[model samples]
Target: MSSLSRRKFLLTAGATAVGTAILHGCTSGGNAPQTPASPSTNASPAAGGEAPEVTKAKLGFIALTDAAPLIVAKEKGLFAKYGMTEVEVLKQASWPVTRDNLELGSGGGGIDGAHILTPMPYLMSLGTITKTKKPLPMYILARLNTQGQGISVANVYKELKVALDSKPLKEAFAKAKAGGKELKVAMTFPGGTHDLWMRYWLAAGGIVPGKDVSVIPVPPPQMVANMKVGNMESFCVGEPWNAQLVNQKLGYSALITGQLWKNHPEKAFGMRKDWVDQNPKAAQALLKAVLEAQQWCDDPANKEEMVKIISDRQYLKVPPKDILGRLQGKVDFGDGRTIDDPDLAMKFWRDNASYPYKSHDLWFLTEDIRWGYLPASTDTKKIIDEVNREDLWKQAAQAIGVPVEQIPTSSSRGVETFFDGVKFDPENPKAYLDSLKIKTIKA
Candidate 1:
C-alpha cells in the first residue's frame, strides 16, 4: 500500500463506521486517540443496589493480541471498579480446553466466560461440533475485537511467488503433490471463524480445502513453532503468531483477515448461558468492565502500552516486539509486501466493534454449514437468538452512559461484502450459500 496523507488514507481505506460516529484513528487515519475521558472511583454498594450478584468469576482466554481487552480490564482495574472483585483471568491452552473449562464452571475449577470465537457459542449451543455430545447454553455479551487475523505462508512458497492471488499456490501444491509431497494447511478450530476464513480464501483460488490439501487444526500460539518444525506448509490464525512468523523469517502473511473482509468480526466475549442467567448482575458487570477496557484499547496511543501489558509471561507469553507492528498497521506480508495504513489495524471498539450484531453471527453460522461443520439443515435463526446476548449488552451500554444516538436500533447490519466481491445477505443465507462456486456442501 502507498504512503498516503492520513486524511487520504482514511478516505481511501474505506473502513467506515457501521454504527458509531465517534470512530477513532482506524477508519479515517487522521483523528485523536479515543480513551474514556473519565472513569468512576465509586464502587457499587451491595444489597438491593446495582451491586453484582457474584463478584468472583473466572474467564478463560487464549494467548493472542485480541485477548487484550480481558487482560487490560484486569490489569487496569476496570473489573474491580465495576465491583467484580475476585475475577480471575486464566490463560487457556487451546479452544478445546477453553470449552472444557467453561463446561466445568468456576466452582468446578473451570472458566465461566471466555475470549472466544464468534461462531463457537452458536456451535456450542447446538452441540453441533464440540467434543461433548450434550448441548450447552452459550451467550455472546460483546465482541472482543475485529480483524487482526492473518494467513501466513511458509518460505517454500516464496519460489511460487505467492500473493493475494492463490493461482501460484495451487500450481505449487500440484507440483508438490506429483512429487509425492502432501501439502498441508492448518487453522485454530473447526466451525470457528479462522477455519471459515482459511476455507474461503482457498476455495476462492479453486483449492478445495479437504480435497486439494490436508487441513489440520493447531492452537493459535503453536502455529509459529509448528511451521518452524516443518509440521505444516501454511496456516491461518490470529496474531501475534502471524507477526512472529514474519519476524522469525519462517513465512509471511499472504493476507490479513481485514484484507479478506475489512473490519470483519473476530473474537467475542462469550460465556456459558446458565452462568449469565444465574448471575445476571455479574454478567452486566462483566460487560461494563470489558467495554471500558475496549474503549482504552481502541486508542492508538495505547497500542504500545498494550503490547507490553499483554507480553507479560502470564498473558500472551511472547515478546512485545512481535505484536507492536500489526497493531500499528505496519504489515510485513513476508513475501516482500508492506503497508502503513492505519485502516488495516485490529479494532476493539471502533466501527461498532463491540456490538454483537446478529447479522454477523448469522454469516458465521451459515459459513460453518457451508463447510459442513454443521448440518445443512441447521436452523440459524433459532441458534442466533439463543446464543447472542445483545439485550444484555444494551443494558450494560445504558449503565456505561453510551450516547443514545450511538446504540444500534436493529440487530442486522444488512449486506456484508468480501474482498473477492461476493455479498452475503443475512435474510437470504440460502441464496448466498447456493451462489458460492466452491463449497464443501452442494445445494
Candidate 2:
C-alpha cells in the first residue's frame, strides 16, 4: 500500500492509534528548594498535646515518577513537618504487591497504606480483584496526579516512519498482521487503571486487547528491558518507565493517556478504611503532607531538581535524563519526531482534580465489565458506590484545608470526543466497545 494511503486508512478506521503535563519547578527560598506547604487547615496540629505523632507507619509505592509526591514528602521533610516522622516509604515491585502489602499489611510488617491506581481501592471493596474477603476497607486521602500514563512503541516500528497518530498506530498493526509476527504489548496490571486505559485506547484503535494483539503483564521496572529484547513492541505504564524508553532510544510514546482523557485520575493516597476512621487526625495529617508535596512537585521551578531527586537509587533508579525527558514534556518517538508540551500528566490538587467522583470510578468499572473481568450485565453503580470512598476523601480534604467540590450530581455517560474525534463514554460500554471495528469479548 502507498504510504499516504496507509496513513489515511489508519486514521479513517480510527485505528491510527495511539498515544502529561509539563510538571513545573518551584523555587524554595531561591536555593533550598521549596517543599510542599502543608494545607493550612484545622487538620494541622499545634505545638502541644504530644504533637499527635505517628510513632511508626509504613507506606507502599511502586517506583514511578508520579510516586514523587510521596518521595518528596519524605525526602524534603514534608512528612516530618506534619509530625509523620519515622515514615517508611517502601518501594514495591508491582501494583498487586503494593495492593496486597497494604491489604494484608505484609511488607516487612506490612504498611499502613499505599499510593495506588485509583481503581484499586474500589476493586478491593468487592473482595474479588485480590486476596482477602476481609475487605480491609480503604479511602482516597488525596489525588496525587491526573495525568502521566502513556503508551509507547519500539523504535523498530517508528523506523518504518510510523506516525504516532491513531491511523498510523493501526497501520503498524496491519503491517504486523501481514508479517505474521505477533505484536507484544505490556501493561503493569490487570483490572486496574493502567489496564483499563491501555485496553480502551487499543479498542478505540481497532485492536482487541487479547485477540488482535498479545497483551501481557510486565512489571513497570521490566517494561523497558522487555521491549529492548523484542519481548514486547509497546507498553502502557506510568511515568519514568516511558521516560526510560525515550532515554534509551528504544521506543517513542505512541500516545499519552492524559491526551485521551484530560485530567484523568491516575493515582491516589489510600489508607485502610479502619485506619482513616480510627486515626482521623492522623489521616488528615498524612493528607496534609502529601498535598503539600503535590503542590511542591507541581511547581515549575523544582522540575530540574526533581529530576535529580527522583533519580536516587531508592526511587526510580533510572538516569535523570530519561526521567527528565517526559517529566519536562520533551518526548522523542525515535523516528525523527519529537514534541514538547506533550500535554502534562498533572497532579491535580483541589477542584475537580482531587475529588474522587463516582463517575470516574464508575467509568473504570464499566471498562472492567467491557474487558470480561466482570460480567457484562454488572450493576456498575452499585459497585461504584461500594468502592468509591467519597466520604473518607471528603473528610480528609476538609481536614487538610483542601476545598471539596460537590460530586458530579448527574451521571455523565455518553460518547466523549477525544483527540481527533475519538469518542469514549461509560453509558454504553458495549457500544463503545463495539464501535471500534476491532475485536472484543463479552465480559
Give lDDT per model, in order: 0.79, 0.64
TM-score of each: 0.90, 0.80
Q: What tens digits encode model 1's per-residue C-alpha lDDT throughout 1-443? A: 12223211111000000011111111212223343433453655353477888888999999999999999989988898888989999998888888778778887889999999888777677865455667778899998988999998998788776666776788778888899986778888876878889989998888888888977777787777778866677888999999999999998888888888877899999999999999998888889999888888888877888889999999998888899999988998887789997778898887677888888888887787787666676767777777788889889877887766456667876677888899877777888889998887533
lDDT (tens digit, per residue) of candidate 2 on 22-63? 112211111222233333323335443525435456888988
By lDDT, the best candidate is 1
In candidate 1 the C-alpha lDDT for residue 186 amounts to 87
Top TM-score prediction, candidate number: 1
> Which pairs of residues have clashing backbones in candidate 1?
252-334
Superposed on all Cα atoms, the candidates' RMSDs to the truth, in angstroms, are: 8.8, 9.3
